[model samples]
Target: MRARNKPWADDYLKEHDEVVVQAPFDNKNKWQDFFGNDQPIHVEIGTGKGQFIVGMAEQFPEVNFIGIEVAKSIIVSAVQKSLDSGQKNIRLINVNAEDLRDLFGENEIDKIYLNFSDPWPKSRHEKRRLTYHTFLEQYQHVLKHDGEIVFKTDNRGLFEYSLVSFSKFGMELDEVLLDLHAYEDPKNVMTEYEEKFSAKGQSIHRCRAHFPHRN
Candidate 1:
C-alpha cells in the first residue's frame, strides 16, 4: 500500500531536529561519535512506521539504532514515532538501501534487523528482494565480522527464499523459528506488521544469519 504523501513531511523532519539523518552523512566510520558513545550499532532496513527499531532502542539502551527507509512519506511517520517515544538512541535515514555501503564503513554495523520486508513476489523482480544475493553483498560490507542479520516475515515464500539465499552466501543460520510467537523469547520485539499478522493467527517466520568468521 502506498502511503499518502504528506506535503509537509520534509519540513516536519527538518524542524523536529531529532533522529532523521540528512544523508550523505559525514563521519562514516565514526558513527559512535554521532551517538556520542561507543555503543554497538544496529540497523533496521525498511523500518516501516518505526515500531520495531524504536522499541528495540528503548529495550536495549546500550545499542544505537538506525532505521532506513526509502519513502519520505512513510519515514516521516517513523520519525514522528521516534519523537513520540522520546528515544535518543535511534536515528532515521531517508535513502535507498543500495547506498548503505556509502553511509557506513566496513565493520561499522554490529547487527541488522529485517522485519516484514516486501516479498517482491515476482520472477522479474527477484533481484529487488532484500534477501537477494546483491543486497546481501551490500550488507556484508557494512556489517562487522561477527555481525548477524535477524529476519522475520509472515510470507513463507519469502522466508524460504531468504533461507536459501543466506545459505548460498555462506552465512550460517544460527536460529530458525517458523512460528516466532510460539517460541519462548521474551526479548523478541514485534513490528507493526508482525503484530497485525500474528493477531490474524498467522505464524511468524524468523531466523538469524551470520558469517562464520568471528574475526
Candidate 2:
C-alpha cells in the first residue's frame, strides 16, 4: 500500500509529539540518558500506527521503548495514538532502519522487534527484506551481546526465508511459532496488522532470534 501524503502530518506530529525524536541524532549509546533512566531499551522497527509498541510501554514500565518508522503520515498516527494512550516509556524516531547503526552504539539496545514488516517478496529485492543478511548485520551492531530479535509476520514466505537467513547468519532461533494466536499467550499484544490478519483467519508466524556476541 502506498503511503498517503498528509500535508498537516508534520504539524500533528509536533503537536502530539512528546515521543517523536527529530533527526540529526547523536545519542549513540546514550539512550538511557534520553529516557532519564537506565532501564533496558527495546526498539520496534516499522512500528505501524504504534499499537504494539505503545501497548508494550504501558505493560512494561521498567523497559524503555523506541518505535522507528520512516513514513511521516504513518508515524504521526503512531505519535497521536501514544499521546492519547498516555504512555511515557516510549519514543518514536522518523528515520530509516538502515541509519540505526549511526544513531545507536553497539550494546545500546537490549532487544528489537519486527512486526509484520514488508516482505520485499521479489528475488531481486531480497536485500530489502528486513531479515536479509545485510540488515541482520546492521541489527547486530546496535544490539547487546545475547540480545534477541522478536519477529512476527503473516507472510509464510518471509518467515521461511527469515528462518534460513538467521541460521546462515549464525543467529540462534530460540523459539518459533507458526501459529501465534493458537499458541495462546494472554500477554500478547496485537498490532493493527496482526489483528486485521488474524481476523481474516491468517496464521501469524513468530520467532525469537538471538545473536551471539562477536568474537
Candidate 3:
C-alpha cells in the first residue's frame, strides 16, 4: 500500500470516516441502501487515488458513483475526496472485486468501469485480470441485463484479449478505440493512471461491452 503523500490526502483523512457495511461478503442486496437513491449506479473496481471517480461524481451529480478498492489506504484518500468535495453521490468501499457479487444483488448495477486495471501479463494470472471471462461472468451476474462495462487500458495485449473475451461471452462491443487519445470522441475522462501513462506516449485503448441476455 502506498502512502497518501498528496496534500489533499491529509484533508481527506481528516474529513471522512470508514464506511461501515453490515456484511459485504454474504449480503448481495444491501447495495441499494448504500446509495439511498433509485438513480443509475456506476462502479469503478480499482479506484486508485480516486481521481476519476471523484471527478465523475463532480461532473454528474445526478448519477451515483461507487468506488471499490482492495487497498484501504487508497480508499481512505477516495473517501476523503468525497468528503472534501461534499459529494453525497459518491461512496467508497474497501473490498476485493472478486467479492462484488456478495455486496451487490443480481442485476443491481447499471454500469461498470474498469480503468487501468492490472494487465496480469502472465498467462497463469489471466484469471485475475478484471477483463478475463471469469471476472466478466461475475460482473454479468451483478450488472443489469442491458448494463455495460466500459474499459480503458494502456496495455494493447490486454485490450485485445478483453475484446475477444467479450465476444466469446456473446456481448456487444461499442466505442472501441484502439488509440483512445487519437480518437476525437468527447466523452473521455482520464484517470490518474491514464494521465501518467498516456503522457509517456503510450496509446490508450478503450471499449464498452454490453451485457447479453439469454434467449
Question: Would you estimate the TM-scores of all the predictions?
Answer: 0.96, 0.96, 0.87
Question: Compared with the true structure, what per-residue lDDT tens digits does model 1 show for residues 78-104?
Answer: 898899998899999887757678889
Instruction: State the C-alpha lDDT per candidate.
Output: 0.89, 0.89, 0.79
Determine which window of 10 residues in candidate 3 has minimal summed lDDT.
Answer: 14-23
Error of 1 at 26 (Å): 2.2
Off by over 4 Å in 3: 1-27
Write candidate 3's Cα lDDT for 1-215 as tens digits.
Answer: 36654556445544553432324555367566656767788988898778899889888888888888876567676775666788778877666756577778888889999998888999999888888878888899889888989999999999999999999988898779989889855757789889998899899999998976845
Cα RMSDs of all predictions? 1.3, 1.2, 3.3
